[model samples]
Target: MAQALAAAGARVLVVEPNAPHRLPGLLGAAAPPPEGQGQVAPGIWGLFLDPEIAMAAYLRSQVRVRAIAERMVRSKIYQRFVAAAPGLKELIVLGKVMMVYRGRHQVAGVGGFDQVILDAPATGHGVQLLRVPRLTLDTFGESPLTREARRVQEMLQAESTFVDVVTLAEEMPVNEALELEKTTRDLLDFQVGSLIVNGLCPPIGEAAAAWDPGELRADPRIAGAHYAATWCDARRRMQQQHLRRARAATRAPLECLPFVFSADEREVVAHLAAQLRATGASRREAC
Candidate 1:
């Protein structure tokens, strides 16, 4: 997202523990666009912020984030952020992205430009990450960390920050998404941001016939794995349905990203960027 947003003319600073991968393909599949390429292209710079450990790591890293910001702040491409993006809705996801790395338990470093879009890890660890603020508040009651947790918790509670929980469109993913969303609402009082129902098979306009010619029809291939290709359309439709139901069950509205067949490096990055850019949720809510 940092690379993609930078491509769209934003000063994007990505804070990693060590050196950046230098390309999206390493993380998934996108290639970074040219630097200082004008509003036609945004500037993306990376900073190392790992050594931070535990809730204490959340301590304002302004001294560190400031240095990187100073370098890119001069770029004309970055000036776009200074203006009022009347179209930009304030994004509502305050992520306590307690991501574990190098076998470390708590998030070693915490940072994002104006908005920290944490592509959080899987369901198992995601819970701990989101709960850091609350947990830290409980453990270290009135200390600086507690104060930090309070600030974090306030952001989480405010409309500005949502404890976002994402999942694939499958059953297990759906179950996890629902659990996380409700848990966030109940425990943290952070309204779940839009439920991101990822991995959805997009609507196949002409391929709708795979369902049936009339009201209802059964395909024998559906029951047999040997004819998997024959029933793929049916499975795709089922996937879509599952995604919808899961989103409907959550406090956050559902936002779906089409299932892309292109996993190629450059293609993956471009596609994800396109998907993010195209999401009405981002545009509608105002960030």
Candidate 2:
């Protein structure tokens, strides 16, 4: 999605807040700079942030105590503190995200990014990570922490900021997507943008949908072909069922990306990018 947005002439920054960053390798870029952005392409950049690094950076700027900040980050007690605190880690990571989002962080010669796409963890953590600001406000009451939380909460609920839930057209992922969508809307009050359904099996024509590989199973010459076709047809049918369920359940618009069969990551991204670009164009026309 980042590549697609960048290709469409938007300055895009993809932030991987999760550990063991994979976005950089996926985008064919070298490891991101420890504190700033790394260029993925002409219009696309990537940033890898974690709680400790972000907290140290924050303390340096805000407290003007660089030594203490570094020492605290390196300490076992500080690590446990972040782990024990409910929303501290999430808040620190999100603060870095906001900095990039608001263009406080810059890429020299190119200025700040037009869009900051966070590659937040998807296994329920993404939803919880987003809910941190609201949770902080509820627990802390009126304080400096709550004040900062309020600011982040307002930005999250703003019309300009949207959370796009990406999932596959499978039972488990679709279920998670639906739950995540509702939580973001009802609890977080954030606009649920498109429910991007990835890895969709392309539609089989009516004839193929009704194909009976049973007849070809008896023929030795094409038995393998028959088996392959049968499996693909079955997979496609399953995808359709989930797709229907997703469309029926979701309030967000569904954007489907075809399953790209390729070993090269660039080719896969390019294929999806073309589809996404077209989807964006159609949406603009409709609006």
How close is each model in CA RMSD to the real structure? 13.1, 2.9
**Decoy 1 TM-score against native:** 0.59
Cα error of candidate 2 at position 56, Å:
2.1
- Which digits, one per residue and each the tens of the lDDT, describe model 1 over residues 22-88? 4434334244323211111235443333222211223233226765655544545544542332211
lDDT per model vs. reference: 0.49, 0.75
| lDDT score of residue 48 within candidate 1 | 30
Q: Please give the RMSD of candidate 1 to the true structure.
A: 13.1
How does candidate 2 fare on TM-score? 0.88
Backbone steric clashes in candidate 2, count: 0
